[model samples]
Target: MKKPMRLSTVAFFMILAGVAALGVAWWTQHKLGIMPCELCLWERWPWRVLIVLGVMVPVLPARVGRGVLWLCAPVLLVAEGLAICHVGVEWKWWPSPFPACHAAHVVGRTLAERWASMPLMPSKPCDAPTYLIPGLPVSMAVMGGVFACVVFVTLCVGMVRSKKIRRF
Candidate 1:
């Protein structure tokens, strides 16, 4: 007979996945000197939440832990939605919803005045796709979206398939 998937095992892997995703995002920004755009920064929140919530899932009773993990699907969906919005913006299909993503126009006749009008913090245009690898066609946002979809579907399938397990 085939073995059933364990909620605790999935939950443990989930915690690791969240950590790895967040770590890569942070490492790229701090170590690689790649500044995250506003939407990019916003994308990290769901992963952070996942890490926080997934930490206790392994210790909880099976049903309760599965319930908690099930709740994570909606969170992942939210992340997927954000990634889609970003992808649309990057593709010029629609403008970014965040006002900060728009570039500030330097409205001054003098060079010094225009210089003074520049934003204190540098910001990237949300429409530009950020590719991690050189010459790679896929964007980071698209990759994240794909990852979210895979995880969301996996969790849903796992939960539905293993319906009778009682312990964590």
Candidate 2:
């Protein structure tokens, strides 16, 4: 039989994964000059929460720590849902909830006024998807959903196995 992973180990891995994902996104934005859409920025919040949970899980009491680890499953599921929604927006299956996804409106009467009010660099449209791997036909949102699902499953299985071992 395979040995079940410790809760601390699971927590550590979750933190690492969260950081790595954010790092890649940052690299893409800063180094590659690829800007994220409003929805893309929204997708990152859950990962930040997960990183906080990961840190707390290792220091809390055993039962509480395990509970924290279990909490990760739902957090990741929500992240995946957000990513899926973003994918839908990208594919034009539905519209984004954020107004920034649409074109910016200039309320100014004069061209100079409009130019002054406009942002230096406009944000990317949410409907336009960015692929980390060129020609892969997979957008960052799709990849995020996949990663979230994988991590969710891992946390679920780990929690279940931990429970079984505790009962024995």
Candidate 3:
């Protein structure tokens, strides 16, 4: 017979998944030199929060730990919503909510003044989507949306199963 999954195991998996996703973002930014847009940076925040919750879940009481895990589902859904919004911005279906999506315009009159006012490294425009896989039509934002949905579904299922297990 297969052993049932424990809350701690699920939390650990969440932590590992969050770390792995962040690690890929770090690698792409540092190694591949792909600077993230403002929306892209916003997407990372949910994973960071989830990772923190995952760490705390193990130390809390069983019922409380499961409640914390249950809380992750909504956070993942919100992340998914953000990813969808970003994908829409990338596709030109909607404008980005952030001003960083627009190109920087220097107000200085002189060329020297304008050049001095410009930022050292140009921030990536939110409208431009980064594709990690070569020759693939999918953007990183789409991938993030799909991953968020998967994680959200997993959390939902785990929560249901955990409740059923508790009943008996």
Candidate 4:
């Protein structure tokens, strides 16, 4: 084939990857009652960027669109990196880099003072990983890392093959 990538196909895949990641996260949070930690929420930003890129793709010319889509490589890497960091934190390899990931200290002599010092909403700790399946070994963060890696590799292969053709 002269071109392995069609503009529509690129756009569709971009949106698909983003939506799938976000949708799964949302489902686990709302349906399964799994709360996300601060780092987990931070990890979602790259997917959000992908969603925005997908929406912008169809409007651009084919070559320009493909060029823009190339940005996905780094974006995916960022997503994967965040997931891996989250996994490391879950495994206790190291402490979470985000301060928000730590539990707030409620120090006060009086009960009311302590209560007032505590966060209004109870935030999940980054070290506690969320497991979806009952017997599954992998945590959600690890799964997310795998997902990002797969998408990144797929995009790279497809783009590299297209680059060989020297036309977008």
Task: Point to the candidate with the largest TM-score.
Answer: 2
- Once model 3 is optimally superposed onto the true structure by TM-score, how far is the C-alpha of residue 116 displaced, in angstroms? 3.5
Please, what is the whole-model Cα lDDT of each candidate in the order they appear? 0.85, 0.88, 0.87, 0.88
Q: Which lDDT tens digits does candidate 4 get at residues 57-144?
A: 7899878878888988899999999998999999999999999899899899999999999998889999998988889988999999
Task: Name the runs in model 1 displaced over 4 angstroms.
Answer: 105-117, 165-168
Model 1 root-mean-square deviation: 2.9
Candidate 3 residues lying further than 4 Å off, grouped into runs, are 1-3, 164-168
Clashing residue pairs in candidate 3 (N, C-alpha, C atoms within 3 angstroms): none
Cα TM-score per model: 0.87, 0.93, 0.92, 0.92
- Candidate 1 local lDDT, residue 135: 85
List the lowest-lDDT window of 10 residues for candidate 2.
159-168
**lDDT at 161, model 2:** 63
Taking the candidates one at a time, how many backbone clashes does each contain?
A: 0, 0, 0, 0
lDDT of 3 by residue, 66-99 (tens): 8899888888988899999999999999999998
Model 3: how far residue 160 lies from native, Å: 1.6
In angstroms, give how far residue 167 of model 2 lies from its true place.
Answer: 6.6
lDDT of 2 by residue, 1-168 (tens): 678778888898789879977988899899999999999899999899899999998689988998888888888988999999999999999999999888888769898999888867798999999988967999999999998898888777777666645554
